[model samples]
Target: MLGRLDHVALAVPDLDAACERYRSALGARLSPPKDLPDHGVRVVFVELENTRVELLEPLGTGSPIARFLEANPAGGMHHICYEVADLAAARDRLVGEGARILGDGEPKIGAAGKPVLFVNPKDFAGTLIELEEA
Candidate 1:
């Protein structure tokens, strides 16, 4: 099952601009941008007292984030991540209960270098949910 709230992600057309705005205007602390080719995203984190905000920009033209930006244009909330102690166990339980897991139902290395998997939006009230191994 879900453990701690990991982070909330937002897809953006420009990572630099978003980071600048979050830093200068919002006075938020941000992490260095990390290119996650496997995930097809250039990512950064806005550090918060309780939780983090993940900013994602497409790493390639074919990236899912690129498609998200094409649809949203101005960018928007992408997904919220929750931590799990045992990713495979959680995945199996969710599957047994009929929840749809995205991407072949396997865990992929995520931003934090931990195993992660995404749940389909339809199964979570239209909100994409990411589960990260804690």
Candidate 2:
């Protein structure tokens, strides 16, 4: 089953600018940027007391974040991640309940180095959901 909220991901057109805005305006602490070639994103995590906020910028033209940015232009909340006790079991239960799992219906390694799966946005209202192994 799902555990605590992991991190809220925001797709940004400019990663540096976003990081600066969070740091300067909100006085948020941020981690160094990490390039995830496989995920097609460059990300920086804004440290928060309760949960982290992830700023994502497209790594390449074919990046999913790029597509999201193309649609929104100004960027927006991309997804919200939740930790799950057992990813496989959670996935099975969700599948049985008629929830559509994105990608190949298999868990992929996420930025946290934990197994993660994305549920279809339509299944959980209009917001995309990511479930990561706790």
Candidate 3:
């Protein structure tokens, strides 16, 4: 089951410019940019009182964010993450409810270094959903 909102992700063409804009215009403090090679993204988190905003840029070949950006040249919201108390249980329950899990249906280490799984967008009204173990 869903625990709480974790972070909303945005695919950005330029990570530095996105971070700078968030910092300067929105007055948001950001975490240091991190390269997640396995996930194929470079990310920076905009700290907030209630939740975090994740800015993602494509890292290497076959990056999903890169494909997303290609279709949306201006870049846009990518996905939203929710915390789950038990990732495996959540995955099973979601599967039982006919929701399709992305990837190989296994959890991956997320930006927060927690086990995470993505539910297919087709199963969630076109919004890619990430479930991170709380």
Candidate 4:
């Protein structure tokens, strides 16, 4: 099962601008943005009350965020990641429920180089769900 709301990820067109906007809106400090070359995106973490909001901006044309923005027209909430006690078990449950995983298996390094897994929206009610080990 899910542990807590680990973070909420947003797809943005400009990482720096989003960081400034988040800082101004939340009055919270910004964690240095990290470039995730593998995913072709950069991210900044804004620490909130108990969870951090992650701003994601594509680094290049091949970035998934870029494609997402193109398809959606407006960059917005990308996904909701929940910290789980056992990611493997949670994945198994999802699979058992007829969910299709976006990746091969298990969590892998994603934005911020954090271990994360993407579950297909088709199986999760049109919302891309991310599962991370607690």
In order, what lDDT does every prediction score?
A: 0.93, 0.94, 0.94, 0.82
Model 1, residue 106: C-alpha shift (Å) = 1.8
RMSD of 4: 1.8
TM-score of each: 0.95, 0.97, 0.95, 0.88
Encode model 2's per-residue lDDT on 41-104: one tens digit a residue.
9999998999999999999669999999889999999999999899999999999999999999
Q: List residue ranges in candidate 4 displaced over 4 A.
A: 112-114
The TM-score between candidate 1 and the true structure equals 0.95
Global local distance difference test of model 4: 0.82
**Clashes per candidate (backbone, < 3 Å):** 0, 0, 0, 0
Lowest-scoring 10 consecutive residues by lDDT in candidate 3?
103-112
lDDT of 2: 0.94
| TM-score: the better of candidates 1 and 2 | 2
Pairs with backbone N, CA or C atoms under 3 Å apart (clashes), candidate 2: none
Q: Write the per-residue lDDT of candidate 4 for residues 45-127, one digit (tens) a residue.
A: 88877888888888866888898889876689999998888877887888898887786876787654567788898777788
Cα lDDT of model 3 by residue, 1-134, tens digit:
68999999999999999998988898999999999998899999998999988999999999999999999989999999999999999999999999999989999888778999999999999999999999
Shift in Å, residue 27, candidate 1: 0.3
Model 1 per-residue lDDT tens digits across residues 6-55: 99999999999999999999999999999988879999999999999999
Model 1 clash tally? 0
Query: Which parts of model 2 have CA positions greater than 4 angstroms off?
Result: none
